[model samples]
Structure formats: C-alpha cells, structure tokens
Target: MQPPTTITRVLVIGAGAMGSQIALTAALAGHTTIVQDIAQGRLDAAAAQLRESTDKMVKSGKLAEEQARRAHDRLEFSTDLEAVAAAADFVIEAATERLEIKKAIFARLGELAPPHAILATNSSTIGSSAVAGASGRPGQVCNLHFFNPVLVMECVEVVRHAGTSQATVDTTVELARSLGKTPVLINHEVPGFVANRLMGAVQKEALALLAGGVASMEDIDATARMALRHPMGPFELMDLVGLDVVDYIAQATYAATGNPADAPDESVAALVRAGKLGRKSGTGWYSYSR
Candidate 1:
C-alpha cells in the first residue's frame, strides 16, 4: 500500500484538550474529523469545550457564524477506535505522555487503520520513533507536535524519525499548513523537538532561581516579561501547560537519558503530587478560579 498523499479524514485518538483542538482544526480546514476517547464523559466534555471555544471565536470576530457552524457539523466524537481508524486517512494520537499507553494505542491502530493511513503522535517529549515500531508503519509515523492552546499557537513541529519517509513528512507539513499552522520540520528525533527544549532550559534556570531564593516567582516572571520580552514567565507558562505535563516530560527525559539533572524539580514534583495540575486543575505555580 502507498502512503496517503492527501488527508481528508482525520482521526484524533483522545478527546482531551489537545485532541479536541486538533480535531477542530482539521474540521475547520474542511476535513472530516473524528475525536475518539475511551470514556463518553470525556468526549461529552470535549464537545462542550469545543462549542464554547468556537462561540468565543465567533464573538471575537475570529470566525464567522456560518464557518463555526460548518466546522462543528464536520466534527464527530466516537468511542470506537477501530471504527474510526479503519476510515481515517490520517490518525493522530494525542493521548497522555505515557509510553505504554501510546504504544498500546499504536499497536491497535496498526491492526485497525487502513494501510494508506499516516499515523502520527502529538507528544511533545516522547519521540514518534518510540511507538512507531508498534504501529507497523514506521515510514508513515512522525511527530506533529502542536503547542498548547492550538488555536493560538502558530508553530507545529513536524519531526521525523530515522525510518520516517520524506513523503510522510511532506504530507504532514501540508496538513499542518492546511490547518493554518506553520510547520517546522525536524530531520532528526530529539526529546522536546525544538521549542519545548529551549523552553525547558529556560524553565530549569527559572526553577533553580526560585529554589535558591535568588528571586520571588513573581519577580522572576516580571524580569522575563520586562527584560527578555517574553509575554509570559516560565512559571506562568508552566501553569498553562499543566504542571503534571511538565513533570511527566521531565521524568520521560530523565528516564531516557538517566541524567539526574534532567529530573523534575522537587518544587514542580511537589505541586504535581499535591494535584495542582496548573490551569486545568485550577492551581499550580499560581491559583486560578476555574
């Protein structure tokens, strides 16, 4: 079977914030999109959130009423992975940042998805190569990492593993462009790809400063905004990205490299252990009224 040259039907496996946003992006781009999740409750929540987001966009004049309606009409939610995968021309797994869960999902997609379907991961830290073998389609497997708040972020990292075909990379790049995103192609695989790696380095320093009492968190954030011209401080960004996700990425990197320095900071870990998972959980580095 040949790789897909054009993707018309997109299956997003997982209905979390990222998956829902991705499906919405595809639908808005005129592709038929399906969001699959194990639980109906999560799917229901995702649908409600998508509606709220589109309504907000319409109110902000970012999207027209007809366009939002059409996008919503083109999007679907399902719990049957096999059914959706079998019909999808492109499948993007946006599940949690866990290797075991991703591998299992890929393994199922390998058996269920059409041979021409391109399989991709939305993982920020775990490279697609780690789960590509399980998919039985390494050449078609690559990373299409979209930043959080997908509607706002413009950059989509299209990362290829050693076995990923140039054709697959090209197709994903085209798909990203279709979604109104800028695609940055990475010829090789690395933890965190490009943006997140740079952000991680900055976050490490920020955490160190906070730990050493060099400055208050608020003050450090102010410095980044005022001096570095960054719109948000490291701590603020961490809250938006979810502290649990930050900890998981750090843990994944540390496990891959076996470097203590790559481990999650004690402060971050403590917050995560306390169930303060940033914006989604209503608290992290700071509290938000959710």
Candidate 2:
C-alpha cells in the first residue's frame, strides 16, 4: 500500500488530558477526529475538559467562537477501539506511559487500522521503538510527543526509530504542522527525546539540591527563573506537568537504562505515595486551592 500522503481521519486512543487535547487539535485542524477510551467515565471527563478548554480559548479571543464550535462538532468520543481504528487514517496512542499498555494498544491497532495508517504515540519518555515492534508496522510507527497543554505548546517532537520510513517521518511532520505546531525532528530514538531529556537533567539537579538542603524548592525555582531566565522553576514545571507523571517518566527511563541515577528521586516517590500529584491533585511542590 502506498504511504498516506494526507491525514483525514484521526483516532486518538485514551481520553485523558493529553489524548483529549490531541483529538481537539486534530479536529480544530479540520480532521474527522475520534477520542477513544475503554472507560465511558474517562471519555465523559475528556469531553467535559474539551468543552472547558475550547470555551476558555474563545473567551481569551485566541479562537473564534464559530471555529471553536466547528472544532467541537468535528470531535467524537467513543469506547469502540476496533471501529475507530478501522476507519482511522492516523492513529495516535496516548494511553498511560507504560510500555506494556502501549505495546498492547499498538498490537491491536496493527490488526485493526488500515494498511496505510501511520501509528504514533504521545509518550513523553518511552521511545516508540519499544512499542513499534508490536504494531507489525514499524516503518509506520513513530513518536509524536506533545507537551502538556497541547493547545498552547508549539513544539511537537517527531521522533523516528531506525525502522521508521522517510515517508512516515515526512507525513508525521506535515501532520504536526497542520495542527499549528512546530515539529522538531529527531533522527534517532533516545529516551525522553529532545525537550524532556534537557528538562530531566534540570529536574534531577533540582531534586538533588532540595535533598541536600542546598535550598528550598521555592528558592531553587526562583533561582531558575531569576538567574536562568526560565519562565517556571523546575519544581514548579514538574507540578504543572504532574508529579506522578514526572515520577513515571523517571521510572521508565531508569528501567530502560538500568541506571540508579535515572530513578525517581526519593522526594518525588514519597509525594506520589501520599497521593500528592501536582496541580491535578491540587498539591505537589506547592499547594493549590481546589
């Protein structure tokens, strides 16, 4: 089958924050987009979040009211993976950051999606190479990692593994641009890709400083913002991205590399154990009233 030159139908598997935002981005770009999840409750939550996000955009004058309405109209939410995958021209697996879960989804997508469909993942840490083999279409599988708050983040990492085809990489880059994102191509697969790897280094140092009593989290964050000219300190950014997510990425990296230094910091693990999961949970390095 000839590689798909254009993406018209998009299937986003998993209706959490990242998945929902990705579906919305496709719909806003005028693609027929469906957000699929196993749980109806998660789909319901995703739909509500999409509505709230679009409304905020409209209110902020970033999106026209009519455009937002049309984008919403283009989006569909469902629990039927087979039906959606069967019809999708592009399938993006945005499930939890677990290798097993992603491999399972790709295995299914490999069986269900059209031959020309390009399967991608929104994983922040786990490289697509680890999951691509299960898809039975490694040439068409790549990582399309989007940052948190997908609508606002301009950078989308288009990562290609060794088996990924040039056509697939080009098509994925075009797709990212169509969604109004700036695509950064990573010719080789690496843990955390580009942005996250740099961010991870900063996070590790920040955690070490906090552990050593070199400074408070607030002071460290202040140093980053004031001295490094970063918008948010590493700790504050981790909170925004969700501490649980940070920990998960850390664990995934350590598992992939088997390096103790890559493991989740003790402080992060302790907070996650206590259910303090950052902004989503209303607390992490800092507390938020929710």
Candidate 3:
C-alpha cells in the first residue's frame, strides 16, 4: 500500500465524457491512472478522445508536447473493475448522476478497494451521504466533484458528509491541489453543492422566463453574456452540457430537496423526451453539426 502522504495510482470508473477527462487530468498530474467502463466500445472511444484532446492541447500551446505524450502513456483502460480498484490508491466514480446507481458502485468499492483507499464521486446533484453509508467505510467516502472538462476547469468541490472523516477531507483536498484544481471545502453535504446549486438556480429561473414568454431563448442568452457578463448564456451552457444531463440534474435535485422551484420546465422535459440531448445528439436548445 502506498503511504497516506501520496496517491500514486488513481482509478476512474466510467469512460463517459466526464470520466475520461477526470482520468486524463490525473494522468497529466503524474499519477498512474486507470479508467474502467463496462463496455469495450466506451473504453476505445475514451482512448480516441484522449488522443484527440491531447493533440489539440499540444497544438494550441496549452500543454507541452512531451507532457501530453507522457499523460497518454500513463493512462490504462480496463473492463475489470475489481482488478483496477484493488490496485488503486484513489477511486473517482464519474458514472451516471443517479443516487441508487452511485450507492451500488460505492457498495462494491467498499468490498474491493484497499482499506486505506479513498472513494469519491463526481456527481453534480447528489450529496455524498447518499452513497457514503453504502460504502461501509463512510469515513473514507466523500464527494470530490470535478467539473466537466476537468483539465480546463480549475475548481473542484471537496464535500464532507456527516460521516466523512477530517483525514479523508484533507487528503482529497491535497489530491485536488495536486491536479491543479482549487478545492472548495464543503463541510456539510447538500444537494447540488455550491457551484452547481448556483448554476441550477440560474437555469431554473431562466427556463421559467422562457416558459412565461418573458424573453426569447436567444434574447435571454444575449442578456447574460452582454449584460450579466456570463461567459455563455444559460441556454447555451445547457446545450453544451446536454439537455438530458440538465434534465437529470434538475429532476434529481428536485426529488432530493422536494423544492417545486427546482423542477425543470416543460420545454426542458420535451427536448429530453424527444432525444434532442444536446451537442452529443446534435440538437437540443440549439442545433449542432454531427
């Protein structure tokens, strides 16, 4: 077992957009990073995406060529969860944003991972307590919520639930720092903790405005970018994040908090129902080239 002072190996469960990026971030930070998924296709796609992103960064001068090369070299792909988890010093599950699914994953990790391993989730809406109890080692399970596009984003929310130990929080905070992220410590667990809560609130209000005929989607986005100085308007950001993802987060948050205002409006629901999922599906709040 590696010393508690350092995490030499990192395991990222899931090979989806967020998971692959999280693994890449860990690898680039000089950790041996293993990314596992249930399907071989997802693992293959993740490898391809990583290669493309690494090349783009090198070309854009955001990353040194040698560094990008080394990061790629450090990453390993697998379908065997137990084998990878057993070897991992830290495990980050960037799987679907559903409470039950997360709990199941944590339960398995608790059984397989080394006693000292820290189990983390990259969930946006769910709190750590939702799965920490299922992990068996609640003190070692916390939420290390890395933002989408992990390499580009500088912020990570390190959340501590009621059962989370101070040592676990401290180690996770240092882990975030090592990955070049500014870790925001959240002492209490809350649905949509910090940034996501703020963003979700804005999205909820923005959707309400559109549903009320207060403004056109374009006008609302324009106002945010021009008047509010937001990097991208709410609708644009939603589209980028995927309407399906937005729908899931909104629904999950509402279910957890029982806040009617947190619910997604009819427009968001309709789009998700129609499978206009966003950039991935080629259409959502706006159209995109496939």
Candidate 4:
C-alpha cells in the first residue's frame, strides 16, 4: 500500500507513549516517520521502543525481518521540533493536553511546516478549531485524533472543525487508511468526538457509583469482569490512564460544555493531589513497577 502524498513523511511531536506508537505505525506503513520530543532521554526511549516493538513483531511472525527492518529504518528521532517540522509532509501534535501549549505548538508548526502540509493534533479534547484559531494557517489544522495504544486500536476520529477545510479532513482520512487505521469522519468539532464522549458518560456513572458508596473497588471490578465483560473496569482503566490525564480530559470536557459535573468524580481530584497518577507514576488506585 502506498502512503498518501500529503503524509509520506510524518513528524510526530512529543514522542511519549502515544507519540512513539504513532511513529511506529507510520513507519511500518512505509512512511518516513520522524519523532521529536523536548528531551534527548525521551528520543532515546522512543528509538529503543521502536526497535523493540518492531523486533517483537518480526519474532512473532507478524512481520518479516525485512519488513520490520524497513519500518525501523524509516524511523528517525530528534529533540528539535522546528527542524523536523520544516521537512515533514504532515505534523501531528501529541504533546501535553493543554490548550495554551498545543496552541503554541501549532503556532510554531504553522510557521515552520510547508503551507500545504497537514497539521493535525492527536488531541482527544480541547477542540481542533480552538487550536487552529491560534495557528497562522487554520485551514491546514484539523483533529486527527487517534485512540490510545495507537497501534492496537484501529479507530481514528477525523474531526473537521468549523475552521477546517474539506481538503484537510479528506487527506487526513486518507492518511489514516495509509496507516491501516479506520477513520470515522465527523463534520463537527464535538468535545471528545464520539468515542471519548461515550466512554465519559460510562465513566461518570462508574465514578458516581464509587462516590455514592454503591460499590467497592473489588466488587465493581468483579462485576465488570463477570457481568459487563469489559476487559477492565472503569477504575482499573482510570488507574491505567493516569489520574493527571483523566483530570485534564475532565477539565477540558467541562470547559467545552460548561458543565461543572462534566469533570470526573471528586475521587480523581484527591488522587491527583496525592500524586498517584497511575501507570506512568506506578500508582493511582494501585501500585506497580513498570
């Protein structure tokens, strides 16, 4: 399969969990992928992860050695955002989920990237139009939001904000197909798009139950496992997602909707305050070594 002409070389900003996964997926799809982060340590980690991840695919017989090598060969890592963005055909911002920070990043991207290049964000919320509003070229900016564990989850929500042009959204969906991901075209800039909003509703219900003393952690988990058939319960997912991220999403949703109750249950605030930010921090509702 050939990559879309507009996204043959992808620049993934902030090469952390989701960012590195984007790099791996694009490279595997035969696109030149450059992953840039703020720090050298993160770049090193992403490179190592890319190698290991592709090598695992090869060993597991999912990818041949040559194909895995090609994927690894197409990946580049850097700490300089401007340098890479300037050369990229597509730029995906997977940075911190702050409106100001993302706005600032896109502002730089609009200035650095070619005017025709697609500039998309992997933002789950905070709205693409708002991010593009701060950019110099709003037409090139739209939401190319990918689900977590980007390699595993095939869903990519192609969000076209009021400011986004039809071309941008069309090319983004093409890009998603190039990477072998399924794209769901959404014409409006709804907060959390479709998936997150649905999950948020269920999450609110779960948290309310916990807050209302409807169930303990164990009971709720068991119920989800036995009855709901969910791979993991809401609290388990909360812990895996990191309380800080949950807080960020909740706040963004609340601000987008102006619903005070849009935020996650009060327990998450207490968890964030205590610095139990979940998997990345090794604890949230539980502790572990990763």
Candidate 5:
C-alpha cells in the first residue's frame, strides 16, 4: 500500500515522557497531534509536561515563542483511544515495553484507526516486527525509534520489518525529516536497532567493571566524561533513562536473541526489585533530592 502524501493527523498512544515529547514534536511540525493514555491522570500529567517542555524551549531560545505556543495549542490529550485513533492519519504506540501489551495495542489500533493510517512503534528495543502482525496491516507498521528527551535528540531510527513496505519506510523517513530530525533507515529489524545496540555494549562493560569492583561509579563516570568525552557515563545515562527502562531493553534483547550478553546486569535487577527505579523514583545508581 502507498502512504498518504502527508501525515497531518497523528495519534500518540501513551502520554509518558517519551510519548508527550513525541506528540509535542509532531505538533510543532504542524500536525494535529492527539496523545492518549488509559488513565486520565496520565493524560493530565502529560498535558502539564507538554506545557513545561514548550515553555522551557521558548525560554531557552530553542523554539520561537509563537511556535511553542502553537505547538502546545495543537496538542490534544485524551483517554478515549478508539475515538482518537479513528481520526488519526498516523498512529504511534509508546506504551509499556511488554510484547503482549504492544500487540494488544496494535490490534486495537488496527481495528480502530483508518486503514490508510500508518502504525508505528516507538520501542527502544522490541522492534515492530514482533507486533506488526497484530496490526493486520504489517506493510504499514514500522518502528520510529526516537531517543529520550525527544526534542533534544536529533537521531530517529526508522526501522522496517520484513512486511513493512518501502512506501511506509519512505513516509516515516519524511515524517522524521519534517520534524527536523535526522532519520536513519534500518532496512531490517534488529533488537535494540543501532544506537542502543552500540550503547548496550558499553553498558555491559560498565556493569562488568562495577561487578568486578574495578572502580567506583563516580570514578568510572568521571573517566567516561573527562577522558572519553562522553556527555554522560553509562550509569548516569541509565539513571536518567531510568534503570527500569535500561533493564527492560536489555531483557527484551536477551529474550529475542537468547544471548547471555544481552541479559541485564544483576545490579540493575537488584535495583529494580528494590524499587529504586531511577530519577523519577528519586534513586537508582545515584540519589536524587526529591
């Protein structure tokens, strides 16, 4: 199937940090964006976050005041998924990282959204290949992996599954470009895509180093920042991304490939089990003043 010449109406499922930021970007790109989550509380929080993000961008001079205002104005938050999906020209699912959850969402989106609408997943590790069949429109289903703090991250991976059509990929690439992002096309689906896969190697080593008591977290982090010139160390980035998120990505990759190297570090599992999720939870690898 051919993609619509333009995707002007977008529905984003889930209104968490990543989802809200993605909706904001789409709105800023002049699309009428709807953000839907199951809970009214999440939708309300997402709305508040959207305002804060747009206001921050304007104040920081990253975005013009008028454009920021318009972007916020274009965003609509809702708890009614079916109603929002019906009107969308494109649907992006940024829900939980569970395969079953995503498949269920895709099934519902397939049944509710317009047949011509493009279905995309913003999964960091679990590729669309696993969920596209649930959409029953696999050719239109692809992965549009946007990094955290979506506004600041310029790279977006446009991943094509075996069934994803070239038209869908082209349209997704154009959509990413329209949002002022650099889109890298992944001709075939892979666990963790590209960026995360590379990061995974670093994270694995970081975990191994810590597990072996080679250095303290601070020392390792300083080495990465001061010597390697990385903006943040693996542990710091994990704290920001949330240890749970990092753990989930690692586990997903391990589950798909059955590679022991993809398994999350024991320390990460211990943290998650103890409810030290990360920045949002006030602690993970590091503590936060909440």
Candidate 6:
C-alpha cells in the first residue's frame, strides 16, 4: 500500500468507446494520459473522438482554448502496449469485457508495468477479485468502474478484491476524487457491483411487464417519463447502455446470486442476436436513423 499520492502519468489501455472517454477525463484533469489500443484504427479514431469531445467543451465556454490545448497536450495515442505499461503511474484497462481478453492483458501488464503502479479495470459486472486473481499482483489491483459518458458522469465504483490492499484502494478513491468523480466503495465482491445490479433489476421487471403484455413500449416509456420523472424508460435506457452490456450484467448477476430474477429476459437476447446493439450500433428498442 502506497500513500495517496497524485497520479502523475495515467495510462489507458484499449481505446474503445469507453476507453476514449476515460482517457479524455484523465487528460482534462491535467494528468498525462497515454491511450493505447491494439488496432491502429481504433487508436486513431479514439484520439479523434477525444479531440472532438474536448473541443465541444471549449466551444461551450467551459474551457479556454489554451486549457483545451493543454488538456489535449496531456493525451497521446499509441499502438505500443509495452511502452505504456512500463511508464504509467496508474493504468486503467478498458479492453473488451471478455474475461479471457482481460486476463491476457493483466498477465502481460503484470510483467511489464512498474511495481508501484496501481492497476484498475473498467469492468461493470465482473468480479474484481477474479480479474485481480489473474493479475498476479492482486495486492496492487482494484476496480475503477467509471459510468459511461465518463467525461460527463461523476460517479465511479471503487472495488477491491480479497487480496487488494487498503493502500491501493485508498489511492484509487483519491484519484477518483481528483478526476471529479464520486467514488462508491464496495465491501464485498458482487457481480455488477451496485449500480448495474439495481439497473438490471429495474430493466428485468420492465421486460417481464412487456413480455406479459401489461403495456406497450410507448406506454411504459410515458409512465416512466411522466410519472417517475425519469429521463428515459427501461428500453430507452437499455438502448443507451447497449444490449450487450445489459446481457452481460444479467448473466453475471445470475451467476453471482443464482436468482431467477437475474436471468436474461428472452427479449434482450433476441435484440442482441439481431445485431441491434443499441445506440452505438444504430438501433435497439428505439430506431436511430443515424
């Protein structure tokens, strides 16, 4: 356990959609962030997207051009994994949510990264302990589960495994604050942590209602928006989060609790199978012309 020191150089591995947003947040927080991806196109696209997001903030008068420039200055894109792993003070792995892929990254990272560097994963539902178990340095590992649209969201789930040290956990929470995110600590290793579990429950109920012909999708959405004052109903929210994510959560939840409630509703599986992968893929329960 090291003291709660400032994160000097942050490395974000895997410049996917979420990874890009995370790297932008870290860079805007004034830390040197190296964003890397296995594919050159992904790295380039993520870098471009980060620039666009920050530029929008600049145009909105939230940040001065010089500040934006400085923030962008802190972010560098690379296809080189070894370089980033060796130099980062803190590394956030945002690769695909597959366990095998994550394990492979951590195994390589365990060999490459400095001993003092803290490793974090952006996994929403996977057990931090399982991920850390493959890390080989579980004592220096923890979960830094950032909510999507990380550049705008303010909450992070700070999770620790059995072997995670108090120092590593504290340093991560402190870093979360520094990045302007509220950190919620989890005492036990639960799949989906806190947010995803609650969200999955709500959506599963919504799906059961739909499947039972209780109401049409529009009617349910209207009820949530008007009666509950929710920005979006279950289906809409599910679309925003991506069907793949919800499916992952449900599977993890059922595995963790052995509860039928956590089982994936047939409707969700159908949507994913149809390649209606939600907003990013252009459709889900809602139609997106773009």
RMSD of each: 1.3, 1.3, 1.8, 2.8, 1.5, 1.6
What tens digits encode model 6's per-residue C-alpha lDDT throughout 170-242? 8999999989899999977887888887777778778878989999888888898899898889889999999
By lDDT, rank the candidates, best first: 1, 2, 5, 3, 6, 4
For each candidate in the order shown, give its overall lDDT on alpha carbons: 0.92, 0.92, 0.90, 0.84, 0.90, 0.86
Over 4 Å off, model 1? none
Q: What's the residue-level lDDT of 95 in candidate 6?
A: 93
lDDT of 4: 0.84
Who is ahead in TM-score, 1 or 6?
Answer: 1
* Pairs clashing within candidate 6: none
In model 1, the Cα lDDT at residue 238 comes to 97
* Better model by lDDT: candidate 3 vs candidate 4: 3
* Every model's TM-score: 0.96, 0.96, 0.95, 0.91, 0.95, 0.95
Model 6 lDDT, residue 248, Cα: 75
- Tens digits of lDDT, candidate 3, 1-290: 22275899999999999999999999999999999999999999999999999999899999999999899999999999989999889999998876788899999999999988999998887888889889889888888998877879999999989988888888999999999899999988777789988998889888889989999999999999999999999999999888887888778778878977777677888999998988889999999987
RMSD of 4: 2.8
At residue 92, candidate 6 shows an lDDT of 95
lDDT of 2 by residue, 1-290 (tens): 55689899999999988999999999999999999999999999999989999999899999999999999899999999988899999989999877789999999999999999999999888788988899998999999999888988999999999999999999999999999999999999777788988999999999889989999999999999999999999999999988888888888778778988787888899999999999989999899999
Q: What is the RMSD, in Å, between candidate 2 and the native fold over all Cα?
A: 1.3
Model 6 segments beyond 4 Å from truth?
Answer: 1-4
What is the number of backbone collisions in each predicted candidate, taken in the order shown? 0, 0, 0, 0, 0, 0
Candidate 5 per-residue C-alpha lDDT over 153-233 given as tens digits, one digit per residue, 9 for 90 to 100:
999999998989988988899999999899999987788899999888888888889888999888888899999999999
Residue lDDT tens for model 4, 25-121:
9999999999988899989988888788878888888889999888888999998877888888888889988778998898888888877788899
Task: Give the winner by lDDT.
Answer: 1
